[model samples]
Target: MEIFFTILILTLMVSLSGVAARIIPFQIPLPLVQIAMGALLAWPTFGLHVDFDPELFLVLFIPPLLFADGWKTPTSEFLNHGREIIGLALVLVLITVVGIGYLIYWLVPGIPLLAAFALAAVLSPTDAVALSGIVGEGRIPKKIMAILQGEALMNDASGLVSLKFAVAVAMGTMVFTVSGATIEFLKVAIGGLLAGIAICWIYGKSLRLLSRWSGDDPATQTVLLLLLPFASYLIAEHLGVSGILAAVAAGMTITRSGIIRQAPLAMRLRANSVWQMLEFVFNGMVFLLLGLQLPAILETSVTQVEVDPNVDLWMLFVSVVLIYAALMIVRFGWLWTMQLISRRLLTKRPMEFSAYTLRDLLIASFAGVRGAITLAGVLSIPLYLTNGDAFPARYELVFLATGVILFSLLVGVIVLPVLLRGMPRMDKTAQRHELQMARAVMAGSAIESLYKMEERLTADVEENIDADLLKEISSRVIGNLRRRVDGKEDLDRSLLAESLERRFRVTALRAERAEVYHLRATQKISNETMQKLLHDLDLLESLLVEKEE
Candidate 1:
């Protein structure tokens, strides 16, 4: 209870501080500011004892966060950029592990090669929250942001797998054979994929059943939606499969499987809000844990110094620099390769992805900080061997890893922001114009459809009496619609009409989707089921038109 209150208070304080910082126009990252606050409060003089469990840190914090990320990602964009995402997420992680590990073994003589690789794997994944400010509500093109997000997502799974492999080798549980490890990796990946698909399919079917049988209570439905991700994760873990993958798969399935279709609009809205809140809370907690773990990690490393304390510290410092430099170089090198390949592929067409500019890619490379999962994996490193010889350099490794994290944060949160400050801000005017054009096009199309309907009706009626009143009414309606659609010709002028049209189109799309959802929810319906039903309805409407004709 005391811990819970303390956390709540700290969270509130951070929220307020972030708000205040925006007004004060400070350049510091909000997360760094939050961490500094916690560190200050937890200093020995202040004497706050905040210890978070490693298992809870992994299970409680990671799944929902990852699921939220997957849910919010535009699925279409993810599908489009799937290849580059694979390169960055999977291939780049392997590169970081191999490159950084070899550098560490050479630079720091005593460290085991496998352990160095493990530490490298831990640091490869980027933090979603850290990049939130840089990505800035995804103001960059959806394709670029999707690649960033998908890479981050997949790397979380890959990093965990690599950490497992490294620890197994470090502890001598399994022989390190390239072929054997490759086979095992495939098994784990395939097992995870199958488990996710199965769980999401079953769970989505069950949710649809609930919507059919239960009373139309939006709150209850919202609660059920909230539990879906954690339930999928827990079930997968219980079955010895990858819970993270399962959660993501389940979220994706629910979104795509007509579960969202069957849901009430209010329920869907509430569920989105709930997930957003959960994402924020989990993100804050993960970073706060990162900050709190820093002091202890430092203390442990300080106590582990053996070969001439001064010399040992110097060696560790040098190793960290070498590892960080190696990782940055590899990240940039891969990104440049990707850019060249992409340019060649787009020879016939102009590239649409924003943030591919060399400056942004450099910023991305430096932004590769070890975040919550990295810390959790490092912290979860087994402390005692089966024979009970303390895991070799466990404290030292922790310290070294923590140092790398702090360095990455320092470079990522502190230095990169300053460098990026000079880059061009998002083109607000261009974005507004694009949105305005989209609105005008949609509104004009609707008006043209209505005119066609009016013309067809006039042809069918074949009546000219009382034409004056009809003319007045039609003229009034068309005039109003014309004014709404055509008033925004000057793109430079701020147009409320465009804003209204944009909003209206969005709401109309949502309502149409909601109706389709209702159709899907009504039973074991297929696409043909809805299509046939709609076709019959359309045929009946046409028959009525023919009878009037």
Candidate 2:
């Protein structure tokens, strides 16, 4: 009962924080605000302490978040930026581990090299949630967004694998050998990848079977979709592979297979709403949990410092600052070096080379804000090694990890906006123009198909089909396409008129949707009937909006 109330209170807090973020006049990021709330709640005076179970956190939160991100990511864009993403996700992660590992080892006395590397691995991956919060519908280039997202998705596997190796060495489970560790890492990573692909394939086939059996039942479909990420994670982990990567692969498979496109409209709509809510709640809870764990982290750090004469708290603080600085410096340096090399080698690929710029490099550097993954990795560290002795520098590493996360959040909130200030917003006009042109081409193709259908029809069937209605529909479509394509004064006027009509229709549909909700609230309509009507209105509104755009 106590745990149930605590959870309810936390959920209320999350909801209020979300509301406050929207209504508050300040420009502070929502995650930062939520973290502050969490800190306050966890303060000794409040007596609302919450212990973070790292395993539970990872199993419950990470897979769904990663899966959602992967599902939403544009497959074509992901492929286009594949090389750059690999460099950032895999190569950059390894470099951060090696470069910062040695630096931390040198700076902090009594911390083993493997432990230092473990800390580095924990901080290497950029988090999608943090990135989304910082970027928040801002005008950052699409390419930059794609790269950031892709890096965040893929780096989890690399970073976690490195952490696994480092932990083995730290715990005396395995001796560190460069060649041996490299081989193990490859085996683990490749195995995880293959496992994820196989699992996704099986899941996809199962979904198809379920769809056939269930016959477009949105509730059944949505429930099955919800189970997918967890299933993938659990299956991969059981196979001793990267569950994070498995979740990601499962999501990408769903996207690639066009399952989302094939799903019934109601199922897609309901699933989207459910996923969005889940993302909001899970991400909110993560930061709040971070806050709740702060007191414990600080107490541990203090206890460790008191017990060890050589452990200077002030020096540890300095090391934290230095570690953060090294992260930024190394990230920036690598990005610049990669761009330089790519420009030279990919001379013929002007499209690829031309996208790299100083502004983008800076955005990418600052965008490396660590979040849930770092928290999960650091907190998951066992207190005792295999030999039953306390794990060396565990408290110090957790404290440092927390410090890095806070610093990154502060920088993201304060620095990122300033960097993005002068950048041009995405060109809606150009995008709409391209969409219109594509529609015209598609309409032209449709007309050809209609003519073929007419040729196939018997005379009696053709008579019953209403030739005048068909002719009118085709003529109207052709006229609209010509007006859009020609872009002359009269045609432009016609296009504008059509757009205005669509805008008016969309507005009316929105009003109707509101009225339907009001009826439901007033109990004038049954819930089922209201939902069915609302769904229809939503579909109509969406179609109108798309056409207008």
Candidate 3:
């Protein structure tokens, strides 16, 4: 009962966050609002103190979110910016781990380098989800956003892997060596990617069999689709590899899968709706949970500071500021170096992705905002050493990491808007043109298909059927397609007419949906009938919305 109640409460909070975000007078990111709401719930009067199980949190939340990101990312863009992504996700993570790791050790008197490296590792992976939430969609240039998203996806694995090595060394379980770490990293990374790809491949085959056996069952397929990330993560972990990368790989792989391309329209619609809801809830829950933990984390840190005369709370905060500054500096410097290198060494002409203006560099630097993954990784640090003693500077590490995450978010919220202020909203003119061209082509082909169907039906149906009626219906359908292909002075008017027609149909469909719901409420219609009607309405609405976008 408690578990169910908790779930309902969190879901309510998630919904309210959305409403509240829109209701407020000024603009604020949805994640921040959700986090604030969570903090409110943790007030002393309410006294919500949910246990934070790091392992469970990672397993329950991380995979699906990462998978969704991978699935949404453009495969072609990802490939094109592969070099930039590697520089950020791979090489930069190593740099942060070593440089910031040492900085943490030097700045904080008691913490060891290994423990510091662990903190650095967790901090290295930026949260692209949080970035998008903070910096509104279409606010950043397409190319930049693509690289950032790809970097975020790949860095989760790299950062976490680096943390694993740091932890192992800190715990005295393994001796760290360059050659050994390199070999191990490759094996784990490559194996995890392969694991995810292999799992998804098998899933595609299984889904095909299911389709053959029982026909298109969207519910079953959607449920299976939902399980893909978890399956990839668990299986990869069991095989001794990076589960994070495995989940990401599975998402990316599934996007390129043939099954989805040939999937039934109903299945695609249902799956899209399900994934959208899950992404919203999962993302809200992550930030909300972090907010919930904020009070406790602060209280505990204060207590720890009081307990140890050597540990000053003020200095701890200062350490957080310093560390975050170092991160920005490192990010900016690295990005600038890339730009310089690309200009001087790579080519006389600036590389499209590698070259950047000062403003662009700042945007990229700040956009490297940290969120859920850092929270998960930092929290996942083992509480005790092998000999049962407490892990050194665990409390300090947590405090600093949490502080950095918050600081980074706040800074991003402040700086990103200003950086992006004057930048024109990404021009979608070319995209609109392409979409129009594709629609014209599809409509032409559809007309041909319709004519073929008409011919086949002429012989198959009763010969006594009204020939003029058939002709009129076929003519009406073809007329719509004909408008798509017609190129003349009237093209603009034709588009306007189509747009207006779409709007009218959408409005009517919505009215019908309301009526159906009203009927269901009045017991004039069965719930099943209402649901079917609603589904049809929703499908039509989705099409209209897609066309408008």
Query: lDDT of each model, Cα atoms only?
Result: 0.71, 0.84, 0.89
Model 1: lDDT of residue 364: 62
**Between prediction 1 and prediction 3, which has the larger TM-score?**
3
Taking all chains together, the TM-score of candidate 1 against the true structure is 0.78
lDDT tens digits by residue: candidate 2, 262-329:
77877888898899898889889888898889888888899889988878889888887889889999
Residue 508 displacement (Å), model 1: 24
lDDT of the structure predicted as candidate 2 = 0.84
Per-residue lDDT tens digits for candidate 1, residues 1-549, read 988888776677566656754776656665666566566666788666677677777778787787777776667777777777788888898888888878766676556788788777787777766667533564444445567777887787778788889988888798888899788776766676577678767767776677788866788788877776777778877876677777777666666777777778768767876887777767766666677777776666666775334337777777777677778899989988777776777666423333377766776677676667777877888888767877766665677777776677777766566656756566767776776577567778877877886676667666653657666767777776676467567765535554555566556555655676587888657888778666554545444443222
TM-score of every prediction relative to native: 0.78, 0.90, 0.94
Which candidate's TM-score is highest? 3
Worst 10 residues of 3 by lDDT: 486-495
Instruction: Give me the runs in candidate 1 sitting further than 4 Å from their true place.
Output: 23-25, 138-144, 306-311, 339-357, 418-424, 440-483, 487-549
Question: Against the true structure, what is every candidate's RMSD?
Answer: 10.7, 3.2, 2.5
* Predicted structure 1: clash tally: 1
Off by over 4 Å in 2: 346-355, 451-495, 510-531, 542-549
